[model samples]
Target: MSVPTRQASPAAPPPASVLPAVPVEPSPDPEAHLGLRFPEGFGWGAATSAYQIEGAAREDGRGPSVWDTFAYTPGRVANGDTGDTAADHYRRYAEDLDLIRDLGLRSYRFSISWPRVQPDGRGAINQRGLDFYRRLVDGLLERGISPMATLFHWDTPQALQDDAGWANRDTAYRFADYATAVFEALGESVPVWLTINEPKTVVQNGYITGHHAPGIRDEPTAYLVGHHLALAHGLGVQALRATGSASRIGGALNLHPCYAADDSPATSDAVRLYDGYENRFYLDPMFKGHYPEDVLADQGPGSPLVRGIRDGDLEIIKQPIDILAVQYYTPIYVTTDGGTVQKWPTTQAAWQQVYPPGMYDILTRVTRDYAPPSITVTENGLPCADEVGVDGSVDDAGRISFLRDHLAEAHRAIADGAPLESYHVWSLMDNFEWEVGYDQRWGLIYVDYPTQRRILKRSAAWYRRVISDNSL
Candidate 1:
């Protein structure tokens, strides 16, 4: 697609000077970390997204999503694997909920496919599509689990993507309408509603690097899409509030704590710029009511993101949110020349760096800066190259260590005054991982793709005990 004509936009007032407000709280005595404990009423759960697991793509009046398009493309996904029969969850959710209950989960976080409810992303409602979620939610409630639903998880309806997707401001309004429709249907049965999941991924991976669905490598369009996504988030929150339901709403952001690769003054600028691109770009708009001036300036004049800003757009993009859902997998260490270095051990997923301390820093930083009413560590898990042992048991020791260390950091964060209310592993069972396909497994339960068998890994068993004891 040729670069679209830049829309002429008027001047919007610049935000105040930007600076990092990260302050790490001093930890308790080192001995206190030996045995970790959580407060009463803390939530324990697992999470999954619709496209990654729900595989009835053409059934029950469900429409196509960008994932369907991207995976079917010649070379987008690894091993040519698609989500066509992902863990067979659409047909196996009853057993899946039983697994959640067996694991002693009190809450479950899942996403709603936009095209599933309204096939074209707007217009008519698909009752059968909504019915599946109704059954899923009811099943969770029946199994003594609270449901948390995310409206969009990187699966834009193909129709929406065909219509310029998030690059067009109209898509934001459509999202609000879609959100209001879901709110009316689901009501407040879902205690927490996440408007968008990792908009940064859409901006960075989907648009900038073309590594994700609806892939496009146009830098000019990425941040414009980012702006529209944030707009959708605010609009969705407003729509939920207007529903008169008691549901808590927020945005699910993947924040990577940035640090200087070396103790050099030159690297400080790179770190700030990296932080601006990776974190503050989204954080400032939600909490401070303005786009990060550094990011806007980096886009420069006449860029789509800079040229497309309209008066009152920022107003719609900044509003009160009840929860701030965080998905932390790694941290970015910036070098002097705007490059990155991996200072910590990596994971099966090459992008992830196993630095548990980043979790504590991030939680405390968000609490100290944004001060969200409540925080939830929605997605944190290690993707292991898992295999079943000869004894027919899956053992993921790395995952167990990953979870234990990360949970210790989370406990430290809470002890230091982050209003963290819940923690959910990235997944309950292995399924089709986007782009990487089934190559990387990030689930507590091992999934046999051929037989649709579910076997709880050692990590799941370990997590069950932690949840039961409220300590580790």
Candidate 2:
């Protein structure tokens, strides 16, 4: 299908300032220096995705997801590892809920497996599949933990991929159908709903780099997929509102705040383009009702994504979301020629660098620029080489330090008038790290995968203290 054009529209001139200038080393407010406590009722939670943790790959009416296909392929995943039995969360959710309560977590953020619920990504709902989430949500509530459910977290149903996936315009509406099914089944209980998680990653990693599921190394396909994902997000928002569940609906974007590697005009240009692609591409449509002109031009006339955008598509994609979910972990430093430069300490996940100030930069930028009603850090944590000692305790001081620095920055963001409400650490426990497999550990709790035994690391214990004190 061709992208329906309204008229031959001329692209707008490039804005004088695409992003406001952010200080390289922003000093926190005076109160932050004294370590001010988070505002009352600040949400303290942890996040886990279905594909990364829930490892019931093919059971009880569940169908295959794109990730399943990718993992099963040789040389696609590290060490040929698949999420077939990841952490066994599908079978051991109750125990995990107890772990959350013990850690004093106020909320639990997790994603619903689309293929598990709809089997083929569309049509009849699978009761057995949803039963798992129902039980998980109930368990969370029973433990006084709020449930924040994400509808899709990179686990596109295999059937959808077979139909050209997000590259096809029809996939957006199909996603809405799937969202409605989930809302009808579980909407009454879930207070927070995220429509989609990290569509940029889907475009960059899955389509451009071919590092993720349904991997395709084609820029044109990535461009088309990006727009369709946005359309799906907008449609998903409407679907949630149609149910009238009074839930806060939003999309989780993994935003990378781009900066120049050095004080050079060419490097500054690279930063501008990088920001246009990484941040503005998603933020503008969600808030301003259009894609950035420069980014559209950057892809050129041959890019299908530019043509795939139909009339009134931006209007649909710009639905009012009650909250803006920001997932920040790294910042990009581009050289004069657009090459990446690494200047910070790295995590086990090589792409992740230790940059706490980027958290503050991103949150404040969203506040000043897009002005979303509310904001929450949905995912932020680092991977480390963690293991249980003979004394039956995991001493992961590195993770504790990482959390401390990041949380401090979050407090700074809130103090600086970012309207930052909640913050959720990435994974509740060590589970499947997609593509990289279980090689990287980003969890507060260590998972003994073979036995499915949960061990609370030193970081978990420290986080519990932070929660109780309501301060870092």
Candidate 3:
């Protein structure tokens, strides 16, 4: 597949009605005199996944992933969009690295394509596929940006899925092997490694919701997949350690703090249920070395999912991690009017609500409850319908404020002893948003799909200043 080059389009004029507001004066520098500061060796970065950004799904001996099959099927994605040629990051990584450098980022977090590296998800290695990441890591190093690599980001090889997918225990072993291959190849350069990105999303959206890849709406199967993914994380860490690599390994969980709609008992119960499904299901096994008993009890007598826990699985899954990557978006509000609970004020994605305090609450809860590993706000950002005005200026004040408010809460969390190390926004550019396709714009920069032109949105410029000042 040929990658498209970004071109300059005719400049549009600024909207007269939305003039720039007067800039606020800077607050006194917080780090000036205080002994408190981000850890001397903290990381600052931006993250992207293989399937989310990389477009060369078919080139260089890369085999199909479950995502490839699901996306290509009719009615699977908005506008029938497939990741055939996403951001073209596979071919234009150098340019992308330049963008990272321009933002003065200290690190860049990206994922490896399993099918790309091990074409069939097992056996022979694809040297060509490895070379692409070699180039990407070297490029980041050349620009002084540390490369943080994730082994699995929900793009399981179609060959593996063809056999039994995550439902089969063998898939977990294959993932560990794949992890070892990646660690051996790039571990020296990529100091930070994440085992997986949001296993909950992988199981819930991909399996139960039938809204993502490997679309299967089997609740029992989805719960089982969740267990296997946790197992994979534990085994993957062991594999990376066996390589004798100096990389720091961890897992990324997407957590959204749940809030009750009212003080009623039913509403509070709804909150617990939602939290069990969203947060504790992943964290309890990881941090406490056991599944939340409440969650298991709530599953009730009718639930068909069986726990795949082996004698030593908890110890392996709870292996000490260097950091906890928390990808937070918005929180959900749960209300129980009668016998049923309802979600209110959800996003266009219909999965979340706009709640900034959730960030602070989540950070505090993780610190209070877990072993207090260094925490990084791995992914946090909003999706706005950013518009380029007639004057060629994009005014995304809403997104800008959204970032500022969240960062402010994060800063407060750090001040209150959360060991909060770094914050990486969810994305750097506007690209395909999974099942929603290109409908949602979450990028700091806007991409004109037809011409592949890149336009820095107002939020991007605002973020650049945040990076420069090292504060919000």
Candidate 4:
């Protein structure tokens, strides 16, 4: 299980001006009269997905995914980028595992490509695909790092999309079958499983907005896809239970706390609308077994898209989950003009707002409002225009501050008794960022794409100390 050595890329030239100075904040130093420490046994790790990092796209009996199709379609991605050979993690898992071990990570969260496992999306097991993961899991074990597997992270088999995608209900059943296949194959070793990663992103980006894979810009189709994907998650969880796998299963939701930009009634209503569409649409079904009434009301009378929730669908979806995987990068600042709600303070992604406090706020709300479940901050990291210094070290001070602020909030949430179990940074290496492509770097490890070099950023070293000390 030896990973081939990759030559380090020549460090990028330093930026003409240093990053804007980070604002100083209060600290928890005991000598300074404040005392704080992360909870005993809080898990710390990093996350990476298959399509984003595993660049052997066409290798080992793997079939094309929607990303593969979208990336090739002229202007779908930034800078004409495609993940055909992004980080080559498929061939470099061993080296990546060493990197994980070096970071003193207790767990490594990685996604299994559905197309890679079931090349045509169903009916056949791709042994080579299984072999790659088996090797990866074994490498992690060899280094004493637990493997946390995400079943689907937006890389649906293009074959399935060609056959109607999530707009059709049958896709739910297919996803269940796929989940069972993955569980039966790797459940013995992998103790933690995530059923899906951010269904909202899948439906909104892929169908409604036409910004991501299998791009289709129809609002009705997007709503349908969203419902079907939720059903798929329910069915997938049921399938995992039916297989009697020992692994604990759940879904990773990209949840953000919604806020009104002002105290106006329109602004408050805007916040409510955003919350219905973003959080409650998924949370209510998973915890309370139905979509929120407000979400249905907001859909209005014109749309023919009805949620095809049949008898017993709620019961199936209410299946007990061992943990809730929460991926919080930023929050949404909502405002209203007349009768229209719009996002405010947009990021490079043009949708998210940089609201770090939202991390603590959302975690608190989930714990207080929903049935208590073990929670993990599965994805929390910032994308910065990182640059290597003249001395060859990348000085990503913004990212470092981002991590510190978020983790401090996480500590506060835990202190207030929010069943917090673990924290995993969004990424380990800067790889493909869906439609935005490689332009944004979200990893603690700086990736020199051309030479496939892995440079530990300042944040990575800081996080390493956090892990070693078992405190934030």
Candidate 5:
């Protein structure tokens, strides 16, 4: 791989009034100064992915996923930690559901384990696996909590990987097959279905940086996988419509709003390409039915990503979705040389730059530009080095403060006409944190991995109050 030559595209330039001498946090709106309430009926929820929380790996006829294979390889994960028994959510889901009810959460967002449901990713429904989700959803409804289930969340079945996985276009259709199976089994019992979670993570971390499962540092192949993921998203949506279940389906994307480091012609192109790669690569195809021209040019005409795209693929990727799950974790400042500069303080996860305003910018941008019918902050929270104190309690003021600031910004976004409807913190409880493993905790409830005891942190107590009051 070599330096990508910059190319200008039709991406909208920042309004002259909005661009500042240097990118800084936007000042609070006049009403935000006094604080506002999250609208009544707005969903307050918590999110957890199957690989991160549901343990029970190799149990009940469940097959292996790519993450399992990767974690088993030495030097792949921190402290040799794996999701073998993460939080024990698979066996303790009832306890977790009770925790959500105790916290006054209106919704619970979780991902279905693909390998658990369809062991090979293509055939044979696992009755035992499907029963787990059936019970989980029933329990949520019984507790008066809405269930939003994501079909795929970074844990691709290892069987699929052996056949080229997301790098192969066929996997997109295969995903629809998997989606249909889930829909037929769960039906409208699961009201919301997210096709995929954070396709960008697969391209950037898994393939580009080799930091995630099925790790590979191949840019050409990574972008190819990105395309397939988008295709899978569309196929999943189409699959749901084909069933005529009247249930809503959408894609979960992690958007990073990019800003120019300086007011220079050279920096402008850098910002365009960076934004194209980080945001538009997924957004444009989903909402606009095309790839960003600058992004296409940067890869050159003969790249694998270009050749992989066939006639009408973009149309398939542009299916109308009922809602969009926008996961905002950070912002990026692009320089003339196509590198990034940190403009805000970071969390325990160094990549997560803590600028609450970025949440507002991204939500508003997506609303103003793509105009998705509705949006939800599916995954947003701060990772802290939290622990249980001697008093049998955990005090994580940082996580509380982080959630409050971001929720304020989110409420501001809704008032500013962003059409944002719901907000979810990243994890319901501490679990496996991917490559960094169990080192950094990002949960309102602390999970003692050894005893698997769930302790409500100060943040959980504060969030419970916020949820009950429906305000900041």
Candidate 6:
């Protein structure tokens, strides 16, 4: 993509000065010291979303999701790739669970497909769909792996999208109903429940950028969608509590900490707007019970983005959560011109910059700003174009280094009193990646797409050792 040239703005009244940068504690890497160790019983896990791994998109009475519609459209996904037959985990979850156990991971975090359970996004539940998850949970327990289930991972049922999707307040209510139905079925066995996963991505990629499912490029719709997602989160939490299950519930957010390219006031102002939209827009409501005022003003008072917010929505969105699941991959560095600064290195995903200090910055910032719940580093990993080696093994040294650096930062965050309990890598195995499809690989274990054979990468061996020693 080519960068657009910026034109000069007419001289006018200056906007308000930006807020001061929030202070955060920094912890040195523990790897520098030989005796360092993570807290005892610190949870170790690997995570995968349903659409990304669980294939069988049209099987077992599963209805279509927006992703299905999006991927099927030509030119939407790279190389015409889709998740129709991802890793075939739906037919091979038992073997996948065994792989997780073999990795010495104590926890396995996977998402339940909304369309799989409640095929239409509402109404009667599908027994076959629920049975799949029941078996998955039981299998995890059988292997001594705790189960963490995320309810929605941007797979909004197509039927719901036809009815205005998340822009409609009714969709939030539908989500609560769906959440309740799932909880009544599997909440007893699944110890942890993440109501929604990375809703920010849904609003930005799915709506604003038109890169993901139900692709629409409307800013007003994006805000409305984001608001409804937050409301759905609160209602989902309430539904879980109503089930009377002992499951802990929360929502996962992919937060990108923003920094100024320079110390100039203009750069700081750019960072302020970027941070407000990227981070605080979600954080403030979940933690502070209101949207960031600057972001609202940025959207303009007369914009439809501010019009959909009805009374009592924020109250519902402020529901207390037991934990805050965080998915951190990179940070944003904005210049005075409001364009991103390409000062850092990147991963296979070009947008993902290689910055370890971001882990510490995000963790401590959330700790100080939103003290409502414990923290979990739910998704963090590097994507590499991995291939099988001559010796029938995959050597992904880049991923191993990525994990070591990020895990070191995670350990430092814990030492700095971030209240982070668990850290789950982005994936257990490579499957489908949205938009870019299968081009990017972000798994400890590599899967041969043609054969569906799983091969443990060098990073997997290193991760297993870290899990075993509870240290880097």
Question: All candidates' TM-scores?
Answer: 0.93, 0.93, 0.89, 0.90, 0.93, 0.93
Each model's lDDT comes to 0.84, 0.83, 0.75, 0.78, 0.84, 0.82
The alpha-carbon deviation from the true structure for residue 427 of candidate 2, after best TM-score superposition, in angstroms, is 1.2
> Looking at candidate 6, what is the lDDT of residue 343?
53
In candidate 2, which residue pairs clash? Answer: none
lDDT of 1 by residue, 1-472 (tens): 0001111111211211222322212133212325777999899989999999999999989999999999999899999999888988999999999999999998999999899999998899999888999999999999999999999998899999899999989999999999998999989889999999988888877887787888897778888999999999999999998989998999998888989879999989877877888888888999889887877887788889878888887887788899999988887777777766667766666667778999999999999999999999889887777899999998777777777788999999999999999999988888888888888788999999989999999889888988898887
Candidate 3 whole-model C-alpha lDDT, 0 to 1: 0.75
Candidate 4 Cα errors over 4 Å, as ranges: 1-35, 301-304, 337-348
Which digits, one per residue and each the tens of the lDDT, describe model 6 over residues 1-472? 0001111111111322333322211234322334458999899999999999999999999999999999999999989999999999999999999999999999888999999998899898888999999999999999999999999988899999999898778989999998888898876789889988887787777777677788887767788788889989989988988878888988898887888878899888877877887888888988778999988987787866688778888888888899999888877777786666555766657666778899999999999888846888889987777889889999777777777788889888899989999999988899788888888788998999999999999889878988899887
Candidate 2 per-residue lDDT, tens place, 29-115, comes to 211333558999999999999988889899999999999999999999889999899989998898899999999999888999999
Instruction: Write down the TM-score for model 1.
Output: 0.93
Model 1 residue 266 CA deviation (Å) reads: 1.5
Q: List residue ranges in candidate 1 displaced over 4 A.
A: 1-33
Per-residue lDDT tens digits for candidate 5, residues 109-138, read 999999999999988989899999999999
Q: Which stretches of candidate 3 lie over 4 Å from their true place?
A: 1-42, 300-304, 337-347
lDDT of 3 by residue, 403-447 (tens): 676777887788778988778877888777888787777778787
| TM-score head-to-head 2 vs 3, winner | 2
Q: Which ten residues in a row have the lowest lDDT in candidate 5?
A: 1-10
Provide the lowest-lDDT 10-residue window in model 6.
Answer: 1-10
Error of 1 at 456 (Å): 0.7
lDDT of 5 at 26: 23
Better by lDDT, candidate 5 or 4: 5
lDDT of 1: 0.84
The number of clashing residue pairs in each candidate reads 0, 0, 7, 0, 0, 0
